[model samples]
Target: MALSKFGFIVTGAGFEPAGKRVVLSSEAFEMIAVGVPAPADALVVARQLASEGVQLLELCGGFGPVWTAKVIEAVGPGVPVGSVGYGPESIDVMHALFKA
Candidate 1:
């Protein structure tokens, strides 16, 4: 089936999901992007998007494997969930960018 709607969740400090959301759309597709302060907040957001008829869900690399799995389970099996992954070459750069 063709994709009509998509949802993406990104994480960063000070990001509030409700206040930091945007929707971009064209004739064929609509994509919703939301920002969360932490990975745990993504669970609620993921379930919300699934109920809102989002066909696919993707998480930023910050979500990582554990949170990605949590989101998938939170959204259940009906919605497809995926996460971004950085290659080995990007490890140092990513670490530097997100270091506390």
Candidate 2:
């Protein structure tokens, strides 16, 4: 993906203690990743990413509609909000599922 700015709110991982803030950045590779645990961490991460001026906010796949709403609400209405699946980009899949 050729994204100049991107944000993904994540939860749970194989790392010890599922709720520690995760940050990885490679100046040479020019890649950065911020992972946050579920529930409480979502809002905090959302605000932080918004502060960092992310053009797009993509929720992790584990986030359902309710959690999605919470994250959106936390990020406010300025920046565009979406998710890994079942979002506008996944309309084709959604339509196929619905038509079945």
Candidate 3:
């Protein structure tokens, strides 16, 4: 997928410790092909990605609740955040979700 200058994509496999081959490039995040387990490392990168102003974050299906929660926690109470499942239908929803 094409990404904006400031956009980035993250998947579950990129967070594996055993598969410590994760890398961020101008193209995309380099990662394992099959499924791999990840814990602390995932959270660490997620935090960094969020801080870097990535416009979109895509999680692998296997990331589960734990990973997503970490992403949310990393995103914290700051910044303009919203769930894509809610549909990016209007600026009102975005404003409502990111109300400061």
Residue 11 local lDDT, model 1: 91
Name the better of 1 and 3 by TM-score: 1
**Candidate 3's residue-wise lDDT over 1-100, tens digit each?**
4444232223443445432334345455432222235544555555565566555554543355676667668767543223223335666765785577
Which lDDT tens digits does candidate 2 get at residues 1-100? 4555666666665422233444444552222245665555677777877887776788767687888888889989887888776558887875785473
RMSD of each: 1.1, 6.6, 11.1
The model with the greater TM-score, 2 or 3, is: 2
Order of candidate numbers by lDDT, starting with the best: 1, 2, 3
Clashes of each: 0, 0, 0
| Highest-lDDT candidate | 1
Cα shift from native, residue 65, model 2 (Å): 0.5
What is the TM-score of candidate 2?
Answer: 0.62
- Candidate order (TM-score): 1, 2, 3
Error of 3 at 28 (Å): 14
All candidates: TM-score: 0.94, 0.62, 0.42
- The superposed Cα distance between candidate 2 and the true structure at residue 82, in angstroms, equals 0.6
Taking all chains together, the TM-score of candidate 1 against the true structure is 0.94
